[model samples]
Target: MKRYLPLAALLVSACATEPAQDLYAIETAPIPAAVETAPMVGKGDKADDPAVWVNLANPAASLVLGTNKDAGLYVYNLAGEELQFLDVGRVNNVDLRGDLAVASNDETNSVSWFTIDSTTNTVSHIGDTPTNKDEPYGICAGLVGNTYYAMPTYKDGVAQVWAVATDAISDGPELLAEIQVGQYGQLQLEGCVFDEANGQVFVGEEEHGVWKLDLNDWTAAPVSVDTIDARNGLVADVEGMDIWAGENGEGYLVVSSQAADRFVVYDLKAPHAPRGVFTVVESLDGAIDAVTHTDGLDVNSAPLPGFPNGIVVVQDDGNPESGVDQNFKLVDWTLIQAALGLE
Candidate 1:
């Protein structure tokens, strides 16, 4: 069933003249608990993004790939144990498809890739693709039939869409499309996700807002789904976007509000339509701490052991327990959905 937000949501967003949620603010959702936590491999501040590779045969064995911006990439298990660590320079963001994973190698300003072995729960650094940009920030996968595509966002607000193959096609990726994102002079861009089911590409503009373009036609103009300035529910520096696919062409577009330490949820059908914003607060079960200053995150609908429906992996910039650099937290999707009253 197709789900659409109330008419009021569209009316308010059309003019962009009033606050989206004046006094009508969504309450914080209890995070329940952290299933697992993967800390950054390097000593400095790392653990920027996470990409989960589901082990279809056994959901409990799924592998989570995350980036350590200070050093390299890390491979972890569903239990959050570090399986492998491949030092391939600084990788900012990463995404997985089939047996391949692509990343933004900020150290060399190129696209780094890996071959995933679900059985071993490890990823081998295969090759690198130059992004042709000074610094590549975020990266995600796009698919056309059996073919794979890599979409990388640069620090200059230029996002390059490419058709990439994992089997020794080339040392780099083949550019298929390119679009310069972000608004005003906000060149810094990050947090992007490809709606493989839908025909859209959603990306975050740090100091500006969230924008989406047609996945089939990148040359087309983009539509601003949401924006942030001084007075609004969304705080400055909009970051990290993830899709929670639901039944019947329905889901949510979750965005990380860095400055406010809250997460905003939007209807998947009408992404521009506001749903409700929620923060990860302390759980009554007293299992995990609240999440603050999240950078990159990912979610899956597949059911697992602890999370029957699925789970969300979010990079926690603050590690209060160890007082370390950063780490990624695994949250139960069922609790989030129940709290938000999302079907």
Candidate 2:
């Protein structure tokens, strides 16, 4: 079920120039995926991000939602079977909470909403509402009490907090506030997650690192929790991130170090200390290939199928085995915890 290869074997060729000590990634053995989604429409970097929806009544029936940036959103079963496809073009990133699913609709320059029918285990297109930003880049949504809040980022490092009404999915969300995450027009900010428990949102500045904004105070400046430092094992282009929730507000924040083909973990709580780093490699049977050049990822701590402690779904830009298009891969969070010796 797992394969242990030499750390040197996994070192990417791009890192040949940098001194080995500069890379603080734990270099744990690669973990294989439990399942993988069907390839995207047509080849060449189509799949971008994924969202996991747990079926409380039947955890085995939980679903995975992903975005095919060129085509639309895909609904897949735990087994990686394509259940449904919503043809909303150029959806960059997606996140779901409660019954509402929100994605960054790049084609329309707005945020497209969808409804998750738990009764039927299906997702349907709700509608989209315009955004003030010219390029509606990445997004994440979560419930802060009874209200659903969505944080959508733009290429220019500007992000907005919106309150989406479940009763009116088509009408879009109410813009609560807009904050400049970094120097305007100088930052490429995307892939954000709402830490509702902390009343803050963590945004990734692709080339720089991760920054946090306290939702309670929109006027305050963004805080740098981590930077593109070798000590933290962050290469350029930190793509996607999601929190691995634990009981009593204890958990870890997982981030994608895209250019390096690895993911870094940090304490979900502030000070946000770096925990470990890992990457998905080929399965023992060579069915599913290693994931590289990842764009976005999502994590859930709720138990599901082989992922007893929950699952992590990541965008695999190169589906080497299928030799078709990009797709998402599902890995058990327990495997990651065990690999990194996390509590």
Candidate 3:
């Protein structure tokens, strides 16, 4: 039931001075969202990033965790209905591996931990541990072998890796190493994703582009996978990133072209060639508005009710309603693959 749109032949070339639209070419037709979550309470530039939690037992019962930078975290169901909202104070970027959900807590200047209870369809706050970086901006977590590492990135272009012991959430998220991710005159850094299959992490330096860091050797210099270039479909201020997991490290790395209101896909393997560029337009039925000025996004390949091939959830900075606050939109992943001609 995947819908394949006609591909456009006009690819974006290098440009010295042009409008934002000309900076990144839209390679495919506009993709619409299948679901949109309830708007957050805190108005104006509050809703930031989102993380999806899959339910193996019941796919329809999966949950989406979103951050309200002015408030806390909001959990919603597959239908985009709010199930619960936790006012944990300025919880920014969020990510999850297995059942452990973690977020960068700006209020406490630490990394907050939460345990996912699938049976009850809820995320319970366990505790938080202080981070070396003050007021961590973005975070992504994953298990390297058997140990869980939570990486909290800062506004000063620095990132720190902390190992968390799940059995003892309150014990310690021992600080392992500190990394200076600033390169290419990067003063601000946020939005990151863990590539567990490759034993590496991708960090977004807002004004520059994405950098690939080796988790094994923290001292190894970061490699530039791609940068803010019009030819590669990236505009300045690159934001949220997530992986569409595939077999044996075969997949696509989706990064938010924040300034262009589009998402750019690159080959998940070495070289990281550009695959395609797309934007989420208003729903066909006009129920949900287009996603613009997105901050953070998460993609899951697990089959869900309407999203048989899984879905990508992104923060919608602008809601169409007169007074409704910002929210997140859900797009079927199969539509993206077909539109982008991805395998």
Candidate 4:
């Protein structure tokens, strides 16, 4: 009986450690029946990604910079008015560094530089990064001290993090470190971000899960921290990622599951072992593609009135022929908070 007692206790503990079933079940409130539709800047061009720049003087009036895949970057006002477009055709990812917006062209194997005039909401093409590899998908900028770190999706199955100075753009991004992630058949690397506060960078592989690497020690290889399986109606092709900090400067990691038409949220307070995966349902009417394969996300602090904190913006790859409506959607975090019982 004593031996049986020990075995029973072990089984109970194992079951207790398992993630709660309801963690992945998201209770979503219907987005207002009338979904606001933004105008498409160009035809046959999918609106890929977006970043927000707050107008400090007038928080009510902010700017959103969106990537028009294969066309260029488009700037829009808070009311979704198209301000301007700079044609530097890029197919992959786009990001901002101060007043400069950087775009990666996977097919061309290049990154383009542009200076954005915030006041006028215009972008000027400065130059392009010396080309490399076949497809450079994921690109993000992180400030380490005074230098800016640029990460580009590398071909041949690895991603390179570069240390770029003002002049380093012409010579191509300098190799700071390389992270080799497991490949799925022939699928390549996709979404990535550097969390400064955590002193680590998160990289997402198309067919695999997300990985975490410590920048303090570049030589240290990345380890798989989370595995996103295609279960519970969650999209298997994970693409974009963005970090949201809580009131105390600690928060969650939000990732997109392109095929399943959902976004998964993971609590990052535990670092190694993340908890709670919440799904956000895509608007059936606004889905740009047959599947709400959402790509690219940017969270703004204090975006709308009353909601002083902020909101998240996501891109829809409108494939109307297949029942997808190409457009961007503003996700009210306040609504998310209420769903998570935070409210």
Error of 3 at 155 (Å): 1.0
Return whichever of 2 and 4 wins on lDDT. Answer: 2
Candidate 2 positional error at 180, Å: 0.8
Candidate 2, which segments miss by more than 4 Å at Cα?
1-26, 165-171, 321-324
* Residue-level lDDT tens digits of model 4 in 116-170: 6657656788877755566777777676665677777754558777777655555
Best by TM-score: 3
Q: For candidate 3, lDDT tens digit of each residue in 1-343?
A: 1122123412222232542334544454579988999887555788899999998898888999999988899999988999998888899999999889899999999999888998998888888887755899999998865688899998888989899666666677788888889776655788898898987899998888899999788899999899886457677678999999998988889999887788889998888999988889888899889888789999998888888787999988889642258999999999998988889
**TM-score versus the correct structure, for each prediction:** 0.87, 0.90, 0.91, 0.78
lDDT of 1 by residue, 103-134 (tens): 99989988887887767756898788887777
* Among all candidates shown, the one with the greatest lDDT: 3
Of 2 and 3, the candidate ranking higher by TM-score: 3
Question: How would you encode candidate 2's per-residue C-alpha lDDT over 1-343 as one tens digit per residue?
Answer: 2223357755753367764443434454478877889888575668889999988888888899999888899999999999999998899899999768899998998989888888899898878878867878899897865678888898878888889566655565799898889652358888899888877789998878899988778888999989886457776788899999887778999999887778989998888998888888877688888888788999999988788888999998787743258899898999899988878
List RMSD in Å for every model shown.
6.6, 4.0, 4.9, 8.6
* Model 4 misplaced regions, further than 4 Å: 1-37, 41-45, 154-156, 166-173, 183-187, 230-234, 247-249, 272-291, 302-307, 319-325
lDDT of 1: 0.77
